[model samples]
Target: MSAVSESISRRVTLGYIASHYGFELEPRFADGVTVTSVADTPDSVRPGALYVLRDDEEPSWLSVAVSRGAYAVLVPPSMAASARSAGVPALLATPDKATLGALAADIAGTPANTMAVFVVCGVEDDEIQADVVRVADFLHMLGNPVGIVSASGSSSLERELDMSYPLGILDIQHLLAVCSEDGAAAMVISADSQTLRPGALEGVNVDVLGTIEQLDRGGSQRAFKETRQRYGFSIDEQKRLVTCTEESGWLAGQASASRDLQSQRRLSLAIAMAMDAGVRRSNIRNALRVSKEMR
Candidate 1:
């Protein structure tokens, strides 16, 4: 085939052994017929597909003839000697799994759910698109909706979804991008499932590990009691005041006031951590105000 036609017609079906060293199946035929290893069972072998067999178990002469539709066979690196002795077209190498996976995703237009993993570095204003994409794909596969957790950080996922959180804090908008409606509901329940605490990301499926800590520290019922005690406000009167405030506005005021000294301290510490983690100050403040302690 001409270079241009070859480029257009050729599709890659590379088989990687490890994370590093491997080979791409070069199709010699236009009919999508190729050969592979015996490790790939008969069920996996498609009629028109290429099968590259590694040379783990081989009665060489018979193995070659038995691969009915296989146009060729790949000998494993372990069986390089046997393959060379048998004069089989065997590739002798391994490849990086991560790199191979990345390439596979690029070629296949989608990634597998089993390999869905995320790595979140420190929060930078710069978008972390890769992580968001993985999250989005995973949630979509599970038929779940996203749930945004208010935090002092920008959500790359939210941006990818073209949604924005109001009140200058990261809201459920981020979750919306990663998961669908049902998924988001699951996330909310998961986040609230555990009691609030520092560095507590028990069930929350967020990339930002600190958001859990922030939510825990900001938990209203415990936080309000502590804050009121430290500020020397009358617990009953403060409760009434917070209730009245809730009726007017500032629904989280009561919860914010009710927290104990430790809780408030943890909240402050969490804010500082979020700031250090690259969360914006405005977002941090807004997140601090979202609470269920209003009454």
Candidate 2:
């Protein structure tokens, strides 16, 4: 996998990493050392790479990493002395998994910052996935190259879906960087409650965050409220689907009585989001007609 984007030719330095994350450097002079890559395992280490030693790992891994040409090491406070005695540059701190993910994104040039990112989080996994696919289809019809990272896998218009690993902040950033490099204008990510824990998306630059579930006025829906945009969908007595957004006015459309309520709600929210993203109403109507005919 490409560790850094080709468009981003700039390299990161150990000093910058240390200062940015408030990590203490063993040898202050080693701050100037440049880091070309990041690795968690000794076998993955390459020249000029910064190897991160997790708290549970043995201190011996630090020496092994250094011997394999690791330019710097990030170790827990307990291993600071060992790192110092190993005669290698060391960053002293035991960052949590989420913080490490943020650090990795920084080292990779923070590619997510360059594109529009939309996150879909809901209680149901299948609903989240369906919404993500429909949103991607709408964005593609709108003439924007869209990237998608869902529970199924990561893919874009230019790349096939790859299901090599579970979703994590690191993998998400890596896919985002690749999508950015491939010139994707927008990205849609699907997440469930389990993946929306504290700090899980710390470094991701999310533009729109929406959920498929109904919005409760009470604090029970606190997680859904903590976003730049909140979209709620409902079916009226007339059987018309409606989506209300904070920034945009309500969008309503006739719903098919034969269709499931949840499916109609998902499509309604997707249409509202696509319209908010600048898709013309006429074009959406045309697309809907074509979609109906195809079905």
Local distance difference test, each candidate: 0.30, 0.67
Residue 186 of model 1: what lDDT? 22
Q: TM-score winner among the candidates?
A: 2
Q: Pick the candidate with the highest lDDT.
A: 2
Cα lDDT tens digits, model 1, 1-295, are 0000111112443343221234533232222332222213333333322233324444454244334443334444565565445433444444332332232233222211212122222223122222233223333323333332222232323333232222111112113223332223223211221111221221122222212122333353454444333212121232211111112123223225655543343233333323433456555444444433222
- For each candidate, C-alpha RMSD in Å? 17.7, 6.5
lDDT of 2 by residue, 74-169 (tens): 888888888987778899998876577678788777777887777776667777788888778767766689998876656866687654344455
Residues forming the 10-long window of minimal summed lDDT in candidate 1: 1-10
**Poorest lDDT segment (10 consecutive residues) of candidate 2:** 233-242
**Model 1: residue 159 alpha-carbon error in angstroms:** 22
The reply for model 2, stretches above 4 Å from the true place, is: 1-9, 67-69, 85-87, 96-101, 161-165, 193-198, 219-221, 225-261, 276-283, 286-295
Q: Whole-model lDDT for model 1 versus the true structure? A: 0.30
